[model samples]
Target chain A: MASPLPQLQPEVAEKFRSTVIPCRIEMPRLGLTFDLRTLTLAEALELMKIPDFTYLVPRPKRRKAASSSTSK
Target chain B: MNTFSLTHLKGPQGDDNTPGLLGYVLVAREDAFSKIAKAPKTGTTAGETAIITDNHTFTNADDGFAKVYLTLDSNMLKAAITGERDGRGLKISFEGFHPGNNAEALEFMRIVKNLGLIILVPDADGTYLQVGAEGLPVEFAPDYDSGKLSSGRRGFTVKGEAYANGMYIYAGTVKYKA
Candidate 1:
């Protein structure tokens, strides 16, 4: 029987699980640390509206092009 | 958690009294910290390197009570109460012919000179709300309102930059007596 849901690789599943863990934000200048719970997809969408919060996210790296020398 | 009600809105004296804002200007940063530190041991010599320790002791004498003045402006008061004013930008105006002519002027000059910190406490007895900011760099704009004679009060504005992440609020409450 065909599975109803698409299969996910183990690495992908591990990444998804790690995203659900809570994190701590440290402000050394203020000498304060705030514990932040994992955000739901909806909460992340809401946070995207904030400029400062959006700046914290890193951009994805670009893929390298294949070279003719590797074709051997 | 402290709860507020209409009944609790009464003045510190339990009447419809209007409380003024009391400003406490802290000394220069290092001096202020040193003042706040506890006194060294009685037998410790001033020049002894052993007397200098990383541990600090705080005492009541370290209270940084610099000056008390009445802040009469309603708009400023509202801004202080709501914390809506920008912590990075603060402007204080004073009416005087010259700087340092009055107590307020002197305090303003001192703040500008010292890169002083400020704590604003409501001048009402039993009120426990305090708003503070540290490491403020102040600039003086003398004769900011030289042409304004209609209001009868002329003054200059002292602009300052409040330190980022330096603003803090403290709220205290009294227990209800049975």
Candidate 2:
């Protein structure tokens, strides 16, 4: 049987696996797409400050307690 | 080894007298030449002009050319060199100048807002580089010294990116007898 994937040297495979993947972001509203490199720690942190998806979380709602104390 | 000097700079479609390093930096809108055609051939006849097919042209705003710098964004080429992609990115900077009239500033601002393609020609002798996509004018400051000196020099900074489908850089060489 033949392998489906091409055989790569160990070092070559390691180099390949270690490379950072680029990021592509699309903004349909603006009709724009950006091809960007992986973000550095600093850049990621800066992005964290923005209220994007990473920062958005649904807040839990509080329910009123029932007035059951009258039965006691 | 071969060497060359930075003698003068020119604007897109500008005539020979279009001011160079000492005078003004020009930003004109252009189409993505890469999608339209291959890179222009280097070393053509002295008087011949390279005709670009399906080219898009726009008005330009001229600013004083204090200094200009260009560099290859090699990181963008990693995938392309490995035959995984087709293009890379180039970074260019246009710095220093007296803020021209409001119209010129507005024109440049419009280019930034619209993300228009531009060509940054760094030599008067027909050597130039085209930047595809929007040339982002990241930083701009006017009247740096508050017009303190009689010369009245203002400063501005613009950073540009080239699309992968277009040529990233076009380098040309000129020889002179020392």
Candidate 3:
């Protein structure tokens, strides 16, 4: 059965899944390895389970800080 | 001198209690991650490293035009983006939203939080502000009188709604220039 939800673009979906929420991150040159709790873009979208929710790829803007935070 | 700008409008059911906000962030031309790594770890509470931002829209449900402008440095943005350094090069800007009517400024911040984003606030001495609740330094400018001093961005300003959004909001002209 085909699901009814609109699907994300393959590239967009892949990037979101990888960069947005990384389960494992390893920067070999920097000798960096950190376990990430961040959600892949897909996961974040998945968490936002709503019929009207839309994902927008923002136009390139200024580079923001490296980390992401959430506060309610 | 540089400029950044944004606009806020309400969606359907535009309500004054629901102001909309759209924001953007930019680092100085020569900024680097190393600088961030060495940046003072002074103004942070809750071990915050990443920042949150939002795009807000509010409507009065009556007027096509109400209060408008991108808001970031306002009370909300300040609370979301936090840091410790005094002189950083990163800048943020706001873009307009829809509905363009009745909305409260703080409500927009709540929207961002609900969406899982944070804002940064600046402190006195023209440095980033921090929240007492968490003790984190923010990256946006402090709130103040609009008429007393212009934010430099001249889009559409509604009276009785005087509040500084942030450096980007104030720098209306420099938004595209930067």
Candidate 4:
């Protein structure tokens, strides 16, 4: 608990209080690394259980030219 | 009579707590790293760097960071904190002005517009005033203005804002190599 009356040293009380507060900012010194190996390992194992050609996904033919056929 | 204690918030008398930052700044893109596998090490209690090695995964092969230099002007570059932690995170706003209006100046302005950025501001001392935490970053750009005849000055101010944590201090130079 703070005192009823705050008292400061004579020198301190004499000086002007110009922007005297300290820095309140603090960084949370921590970063994250994703474990893709562990996450995809389960999926990889699950893939091994499936037949080689269980489902064939049909994709559109690779377009040689972009939608626009204008000059390069 | 008695006195109250203002522990970490205030320092002892005669300590230098001066305000304002230097004119030069270091900036990098957010995606410049695959991921910061480790947080950058700050040397001081207030989070500054020391002579020790840095810890991080700065994965950018080409664009590590660009040092944007500004003329020696009072308060040329600055960073400010906003918002509170009542379930809402903080925000940071930075504005750096360079005195010029030529095409050379505008060339840099064109690139930073509306892109996520990482800013590192140096103080008069060996510390840095930084914004945008590791994973979270800021969006920055510039605004050009040619001053009036009375106090005419032609220049551009790089301004940006983001919902960030708060400002930080780095004791020494920043390491860009992963």
Best by lDDT: 4
What's the CA error at residue A61 for candidate 3, in Å? 34
Candidate 2, residue B43: how far the Cα is off, in Å:
15
Q: What tens digits encode model 1's per-residue C-alpha lDDT throughout B85-132?
A: 563433332221332246676556655544444332333332322232
* Predicted candidate 4 versus true structure: per-residue lDDT over B68-92, tens digit per residue: 7776653444334455556555666
Total clashes for model 3 = 62
List candidate 2 segments past 4 Å from native.
A1-72, B1-26, B30-36, B40-90, B94-98, B133-152, B161-178
Q: Which stretches of candidate 3 lie over 4 Å from their true place?
A: A1-8, A11-16, A19-72, B1-106, B109-134, B139-178
Native contacts present in each candidate (fraction): 0.00, 0.00, 0.00, 0.00
Model 2, C-alpha of B2: deviation from truth (Å): 24
Q: Which residue pairs show collisions in model 2?
A: B25-B63
- On TM-score, the candidate that comes out on top is 4
Q: How far is candidate 4 from the true structure (C-alpha RMSD, Å)?
A: 23.7
Model 4's i-RMS, to one decimal, reads: 14.9
TM per candidate: 0.30, 0.29, 0.19, 0.53
Q: Return the lDDT, model 3, position A26.
A: 25
Local error of candidate 1 at B132, Å?
Answer: 4.1
**What are the Cα lDDT values of the candidates?**
0.32, 0.32, 0.27, 0.50
Residue B36 deviation, candidate 2, in Å?
Answer: 4.6
lDDT of 1 at B91: 36
